[model samples]
Target: MPSDSDPRTDTTVVAAPTPVSAERILEAAHRLGLRYFVDDEGDVGIPWRCVVVHVIFQDTRAVQLRGTWHRIADTEHLAALRSLVEDWNATRIGPKAFLTVGDGGIVRLHGEITYPLDAGMTDAQIDDFVFTGCRLIVALVREAEEVFPDSLRGSLEP
Candidate 1:
């Protein structure tokens, strides 16, 4: 028989997984002391130095953390940017990086990481996921800055 002080004698309580929701994601951001904004579409966005990380839910079954780098590249640089994105995606383990071209041939960079929460998640799991996503995306932006110093239009400080 185990004694009263034995480790096996202590009862452990397990927390049930909480349903995924925008409110829960916002709450996690709040707990991290991050400044976040809700868009007209109810999207939660956390602005970083040169990126805005958005937390979006997909039918409550998955969460996508997306970061948009606020730098513009001309169409002339499309080939180089595409090569960079391809190399980044090939070598990086997380937050798939990609490029988008808008009107007037403006090129933009984006990074995204997704987490499937089909079975829900505990508070600790949610917090860790949010934190990890943000860090990885930010790292991608920093690398972009290093690789294309003249591409940035605004200050990366903040």
Candidate 2:
């Protein structure tokens, strides 16, 4: 017979899931020792050098980590940039990567990863998501630098 104190007889206590919020995301970033700032619109953002990752809370019960690369590419490199974005989207389990062409045909790179939080998450999960999201987007930017050596304008350094 198994006693109450037996290892197999111990009751398991489950903690409630933590609801996702911008505050929770910021708290996780803080615990990771990352520097963050609130935008003029009150959104929380983490800057990785020239890349800024925004922690966005959605009304649909989701949290998104969106990052924008600071470098702008000339339209002359559009084909190569498109190929890179396509290959990344096709081969990677993202942080989906893409390019945005602005006025005067200038191109910019961006990446984003979203997590559904309808059922909520644990503190560990939130921290992991924040860290992973930031790292993945930064990786995308680095890969772009490798693909186009001197084409991207602006410094990636702080």
Candidate 3:
């Protein structure tokens, strides 16, 4: 899924398949101050692993300041920052290989969410900067007998 040592994607924690619940996960995310970012079709970006829904929060985390949500973050949180960059890079340049969890089991690289980036943006600034840019990529693993189910079971794995 990766060619060359693109620093943005290197050494990133592989998105793993974790069994979890969606509603509770989303509630926790909101507690962290993440808002719902809906796509044109109105589907929110939620992460699930192998037929289980995990984190149900905005793919982008925005910070509220001065009567507006501004993209910002501390410089120390680079690991999480890199993941966002890699995800964005995969979307704009070409296909991305993500560790996907589905009913068929956990697999890497099938489909990816694409987007763009700005120069010299740090994780702190990225929160609000990325808020409006991401495409909603909800994860749903195929059930052995069902395609996709409404409302998954278990807690989200962050």
Candidate 4:
């Protein structure tokens, strides 16, 4: 039973379940196979290459993911990595990289996935964020290895 004015009257439509609270978001994180630490305030911290995401709780119904890469402490290494990151950002396909050169001459690079989850996210939607973020991290680590052949030496650490 559908009315002519109903948007779903012409095609099959299934609404996505929204993930709004800390518990549901944590569940989605588990489904993504990622180890997450949720604090008393309902913030989420999950590991990523070079960066860590602090999924800050907004209202009871929303959150925002912010990631900051680890800083390279050596001045020479920092400069070298910055050059490499700049080159890769110009060529590689993914979210645009953001960076900072802070005190102690450290260089840090970070990237964010553009998942529109204002209301929250479905499990599938959460997967989109997790998968895309991991891929981008891999790409960055590969490019960084090329920049510091000796320092980067082996694969990403556990």
- lDDT score of residue 47 within candidate 4: 73
Off by over 4 Å in 1: 1-9, 152-158
lDDT string for model 2 (1-78, tens) is 111343685865455566888788889999999999998988999998769999887885788899988778777777
Order of candidate numbers by TM-score, starting with the best: 1, 2, 4, 3
Q: Which candidate leads in TM-score?
A: 1
Candidate 3 lowest-lDDT run of ten: 62-71
TM-score attained by model 4: 0.63
User: In order, what lDDT does every prediction score?
Assistant: 0.84, 0.84, 0.31, 0.61
Instruction: Return the TM-score for each candidate structure.
Output: 0.86, 0.84, 0.20, 0.63
Distance (Å) between predicted and true CA of 135, model 2?
0.8
Better of 1 and 2 by TM-score: 1
lDDT of 1 by residue, 1-158 (tens): 11134468576566778688889888998998888999999999998998999988888678899998988877787787788889989998988999998876777999999989878888778888888899999999998888898844332222
Error of 1 at 86 (Å): 1.2
- Cα lDDT of model 4 by residue, 1-158, tens digit: 21134466675554465656656657767887887787786577777655666665545544555566554434556556667767877987764566676665555666655545466665666666666765676567556655565642122232
**Model 3 global lDDT (CA atoms, 0 to 1):** 0.31
Measured with C-alpha atoms, the lDDT of residue 8 in candidate 2 is: 83
Report the alpha-carbon TM-score of model 1 versus the true structure: 0.86
Residue-pair clashes per candidate: 0, 0, 13, 0
